[model samples]
Target chain A: MKTKKIATYGLLVSLAFILSYLESLFPIPIPIPGIKIGVANLVVMIALYGFGSTQAFVLSIIRIILVGFTFGNLSTMMYSLAGGLLSCLLMILFKKLKFFSMVGVSIIGGISHNIGQILMAILILESASIINYLPALLITGTITGTLIGIIGGLIEKRLKKFLVNY
Target chain B: MIKKNDFILIGIILAIVLLIWSLSFFKINWPMNFFMKTEGSKVRITVDGQEYKILDLDKDTTFSIEQENGKFNTFEIRDGYVDMIDASCPDKICVHQKEIHYDHETIVCLPNKVVLEIIDGQVNEVDSVAN
Candidate 1:
């Protein structure tokens, strides 16, 4: 059982990395530095509900490291790390709260992720002017985050059944 | 099945999208410069505010601009240069897009809360177009 769990987690990590990289290929055309589709979070969401928070958290970290090594883009890696960490934390918190449902948790996680990246940007730029972009980022973040979260939620539900049977 | 709250949230989202879409036409500003000149045309760009320009689009001929706010704004060339593009803003999402190509469309730098759009060339159409 232990070996199976470890192998399963490894598979999930690889799947997540692939999904994330695939999503990265989608050209947003905006070129605002660090905007992404958040597709890999779907896997995180699945792991969160189906595999448990601890497992999901582990998967997230591993995925982040793999992506960072593969892309070798420091700026993107920083954003991903900050955003992914905050998002995972938020998702877990919201899940515990049981207030808005898993989808809501995922959305909130997405928003936190963007905000984290923006904050990181502000610090790196050493200019408060970047804060001006908050409203716009928030608006976009919420919209995209929600969509991603819902998709993740659905996948999580489906995975729950599969995991139980397996 | 989506709950009533989810339904309401969706409605709210639609309303916000519509509102933002409509507000996009309010005033789009593209960062530019009339005084700065490249090899041939005038340049309009946004920088760290250390450098700025005042362009007379109607009075100058062959003007060029360098983007200041990165990808926040888009530019278009018509009788005059206009900024029209989409953005990542939930509201300003369409505001900070690629600048336009025709006489219409504009670029907006929402992070800078700036809008760059085109105006009628009637001010000094030929004189400014030269820059």
Candidate 2:
């Protein structure tokens, strides 16, 4: 990657980090656990569609870490890490499978992140009882993920007019 | 076509969220837990997938459950609470949760694959009599 490209990616990552933190400050009307209107993810979904899977993955992780550090809440870091990794992985995999469109990838990413985090919570708690919470998380994930993805796809379609080739 | 798909995705996500929220919100009654622990020589329990029950009593016995390698983790009961003490997984979030004893409380350790809860059971004879 060229230095200029690296700088651009870094900017993208920073921008995403800021957005994620900002979204955290936004109150999600839904009271469901793990439900969020993560506006930062909109950028990530766009990057994945316009750029490449690898770049998007890097962006997601950087955002999570940056948000985690800024908030100084090391405890919830694992949840973020697990969710981010799973979402990115699923998005890329689905993209390779020709799964619908960028919006679809974002939905998959959102749902997978929730599933991954629940799995993380289940494993940590040594209790399957909480599995009942899945339906709620998945539901919220789908809604938020799809919304972000659609926004991303729109942005990507517009950005395609530029000289960027993923 | 992409626009239509986006609408469908959005609709699906919204439907799910609504369904889940309604179910969670209107849940009139909580479910019961079958694995209730009693005071005995051995406190056998499962954590994450490993089964570790403690013998030789302590101040306040707390059980932490975790799972590892498709097996339930056996946690150590210490300090009137439970801790992973040892595990094979890379993350140990369950071990960090504070001990819980209330009927509705639960301790979740994600890495170890354990979910320790105060299983609902009939109160003991003495407590039952008191009640």
lDDT of each: 0.61, 0.63
lDDT of 2 by residue, A1-166 (tens): 4976787698788889878778778757543335667687787777777778888888898888888888748656787788778888888888888746776777788888888777776555555556655666777677777678767767777888762742
DockQ of each: 0.06, 0.19
Interface RMSD of each: 7.6, 7.5
Best by DockQ: 2
Model 1 has a DockQ score of: 0.06
Candidate 1 per-residue lDDT, tens place, A1-166, comes to: 8888988898899989999889777757554544666778888888888878899899999999899889748867887888889889888887887766665676677667777887776565443434444555566766776787677766766667678943
Output the number of the lDDT-best candidate.
2
Query: For candidate 2, lDDT tens digit of each residue in B6-109?
Result: 56766776776666556546642223233543432223354435665433324544333333345344456564344445444443434444444434445454
Model 2 lDDT at residue B109 = 42
